[model samples]
Target chain A: MNDVIITAIQQTLIEGNVETAETAARAALEAGVDAQTILNEGLMRGADIVGQQFEAGEVFLPQLMFTARALKAAMAIITPELKRLSAESGISSSKGRVVLATIQSDIHDIGKNIVSTMLTTGGFEVIDLGVDVPIKRIISTALDEGADIIGCSAMLTTSMPFMSDLIKTLEAMGQRERFKVMIGGASVTPAYAERIGADGTAANAVQALQLARQFMQNALA
Target chain B: MDYLEIIDRSDSGEYISEENWDLEKVAMTCMRLVSQYDLKWDRQNLVPDDPALADRVFAAGLALAVEIGAYNRSSERILRFERDELESALRDMKQTLSMGQGADERVLFARQIEDSRPPLVWAGNPGAPHPEALFLPAVVSWAQEPIVDLITCGTLAEVDGREVRTGEALEITATRRELTYLHQALAHVGRPGMGMLAAQSSVSELGDLAAANPDYLRTCDAHLVPMLNELKIDNRNIARAVNSIEYGMRNGGLYCAISGGLGGDAPGCALISVASMILGLLTNRADYHILHPIHIRHVATSTREVLWVESVVLQAFARNAPAIIVTDVYPKSGALTRELLYETAANALAITVSGGHLEGCGSADGLVPHATGLEPRLMGEVGHAACRQGVTRAQANQWILQLMEKYEHVFRMPEGNPGARFDQAYDLETLQPLPEWTRMYEEVKTELKEMGLDLSG
Candidate 1:
């Protein structure tokens, strides 16, 4: 019965039916299926398939976005249960925490938001700082939240220099070692990331998740 | 109505989230319409040879425009248009624009596919960031190129050692400085009355407004007002559009639609691009449209998918509307290399055969200060050569696919090369390509000739 409910949740997410996915989440929880199992075996499993399909070009961005939205809805239903379970068991459950933002002087943020959605669905906690964010604010928030990684995006060639400025500021503050900095956008290159002293860089959301995961693994080790 | 009325309408439209408008409405609408029209991209043919396919794509784009409309980020609204309004805008749009005066005078008009008239070259280091000190030399490099018909120089990376701020005094000063440098460059080349595109340094309306007068930017000159990607526009853009009209300047709307963005793939990007050109005409009262379908994965327009997108979008405009169309060739490779030449040649060929007047030489994808005269000179040269070859759309598509294979590997480079800087690629005093860069250019021309592309003018 629990397996049936979990599969229903997973299939609903894959279908990108947000309402049905939400309902399936509640049904699974009511059926006494554990929160982690639902998230791992159901939503994340569905998300993994969606990500693969997207990578393969079988599904375009809109379908990916719809699937992401459905997964977000399912997560909303299961998150409180996750917190309660963690509190009862005296353990925290999350891959890592990420802070994402589109750097200053550029208002383009669709790519940043997509990365945020991907990171969130991939089980990492994400704090999106939105667009036109200054360098100081990004560092302060990352420090305050004890974020595991900082992802910066800038779409305009005019605004690409801010990523370099961010690294310089982080180094000057002597707190550069505390966080992993990743830079990307349409104009950003992997060499730019290295020149700007970022820990890593990614071209898209899927690669970003891989970078974040690698950073987290290195941090934990 | 006029610009202010359009602004008011933009402000009064239905409120929606930026995500829903860009991701849901634009994406889903374009995708479903693609399916409804039975529009399937032929991976083998980058440029569609069939007239019916081009019409179907345009029809789907028009349908999507009517259904989804454009979003206004500042007002949090959807700037919906009526069929009659769009029709009237199309019917009344000035089909031809005479830019500049005297010996440098040129006419920009709506073009059909395989239009025999030579594609006008609007050459410059568009959007490439440059040191304030190197600005004049760089501007002169582009202006002095005899093949270049129009000019729009690169933006000054700094003014008095500080980054340019939007709506600030720096914007005004920098814009004036940009025009001064452009004027100086033109006079240096003795093409003093050359038609130029201006105000690229402007971060807001202040620069355009401050520079819109005849002294800085002339009535014959054009000013750029870009529609933010995924069909979003702001008050600053609106103000610039209106300001240009008031000053009798041509309002040029720049739209760079991205794949994996609002548009899903080549087909989706083409559809969204068509809708964007129409909306740009109605909303900005634009005299010409610069349509660039950029691929997000490589940040370069020389790839197979981007070339396909560019061809189809330009063909759609060519076949349907009698509107002035200008497209850009953003080479992923930096200047002074054989790779840059090959990429520029392929991109230039695609723009020429698919019916777009080329407007670029964005070396290193406009990231580095590495742009030089030779690549743009090559763009015009190769474009004119392609035009003379009587290249068919199918032939251009096949050649483009083969050509992309030569330089697409560069996209895999980790730090996209800022390429060789201006000083490295050109002689500053003479504004000519250095010997090594000249050698590379000659060698690539031969290589292109060997590949069956006619380079002889």
Candidate 2:
């Protein structure tokens, strides 16, 4: 059982095939292996390999999409088992909800997809509103979904200013305190993030996950 | 393989070109010297500066002329019109133009190549003097006749934020004007020239430029596609041609191109990286030139490692691509001194002589189209000598080592102070150059001349 679970986890991580990873998780549960070990070893490890492949240029957008799909596949298979296990043990709780969108007037979604994949792995349920979403709609979604945080992605130099506008609009709406805004993209630098008054900034997908977690924790505290 | 079939067949993916001509016959019958002479052939017999190779190139051009028989369609590489043929074709095309004759295919073909020749650097608003324009006298002086290695007509924008004034016209009208400017500027430069194209400032979208100016797309041979139609053909905003497909031409303005330089290159990756980069260039040959645009300043390890690795990469890419490549070099800090200039020139020359085609001279990044002067000329000397100096790898290495030294100091300076742009950095006429500066250009030129660089010739 341990061997099957771990090998599936290993294959998921290394080969980036999420369905196999999911199958491994399901099989492990049936064989009485701990569900937590399956996910912690399988899904997270799968993500790390994808990130590495992305950085190494061994995987570009198309490959990244496949890995993300695989990760989702594995996660879908493991979710109920992991949840049942957590419910039985009484250790799991809702981590919080995050909303992600490529900011207004920019259509680039590739980077946004990478960040979303990582965030999902980090235990947040994300609602992606897609690209060219206007500021009012983003703020409204935050309010409507009772989201814990909002992540904005703008891939163009011309369009990134709207991220700041979103924040400013939140302030004008007098609900700035209700949301934690984090920005990511190729054109938006850390200095720019700071100048725009974003709560935090992310350079790549890995940083995005780390920043989201940190921002959520600090906001709660 | 009729490469044109590659474009013609839309749905038949992966079919051996339906035209069924053996690859060499099509390559030879057409004037794609880059394709015909490219690494597929025996490179041992060819050299760019070698009179024989250039002659072979000319012969290839003539063969294409013979194959086509008459100027009925635009040629790919063959500029076969003889003095008589050119006159007849030119007369007939002009007659067509005057009489509104039915589709001057010969003229259309000639115009296609002419249009493809690097958009003459359109120096927009040349009539108004830019403080930057002050250096033009020295630049033109240095560039006349044999010194004109290749010129892309330069343009300057009068921009107010995101909007350029040119954007005021109907998007399509402005585009036609922009295309007209390209054609007009090509005529203005007045020689069988090189293309350095311009964009119609920033408009809403690429299509708007055409939609606003339908006249820009007014060519009768093809209705679905008009304007520049090779593939991946692009006009650099400055000179940093972005992304591979953009290099290949995302819009209609493009003839296909392969991106050069490593946007995400890491150390020890040069040989493999450059080898792959060259492969991408050849996969599409009409527009993309297989040149390594090298830079050391950006991250992915250290500068020296980047430069050294890129040198090897450039040599390999140029050798394998068997095509013209432009090498990008960064200018270092400090005053514009001749020693520093030549040192950089020498380094560039070494790589280029190893068989790089065009050279992106001096601080070749976001700072492209930097008041063009000494850098390109100095770089050209080394590039010229590259073909002449070393046929063997080791000889080219030694020659580049000698050249790379003079310009290493350039990197040390505060960013943007390329020695060639000294006029902008400081008043060149008023602020006298340091003694070492005066001798540097002379010394390097003399040495390059000795190395068989024909700067004048």
- C-alpha local distance difference test of each model: 0.82, 0.44
Q: List the residue pairs that clash in candidate 1.
A: A191-B415
DockQ of each: 0.42, 0.10
What's the true lDDT of residue B177 in model 2? Answer: 44
The residue ranges of model 2 lying beyond 4 angstroms of the native Cα positions read A1-4, A49-66, A83-156, A184-187, B1-158, B161-195, B203-378, B390-457
Where does model 1 exceed 4 Å of error? Answer: A1-8, A55-58, A97-99, A134-150, A157-182, A186-203, A214-221, B165-169, B416-418
lDDT, candidate 1, at B32: 88
lDDT per residue as tens, model 2, B115-197: 11221111111111122233333234223424333333222222222312222433334334444554443344343232332
**Chain B TM-score for the candidates in order:** 0.97, 0.47
Error of 2 at A66 (Å): 4.4
Give a tens-digit lDDT track for model 2, residues A1-221: 58656766767656656567667667777887776777666666666676667655464333444455666677677778778877898866335678899887665554676677667655677888866788889888889999988999975444566788899999999998888889987546678888988888876777888888888778668
Angstrom error of the Cα, residue B374, model 2: value is 5.4
- In terms of lDDT, model 2 sits at 0.44
The whole-model C-alpha lDDT of candidate 1 against the native structure comes to: 0.82
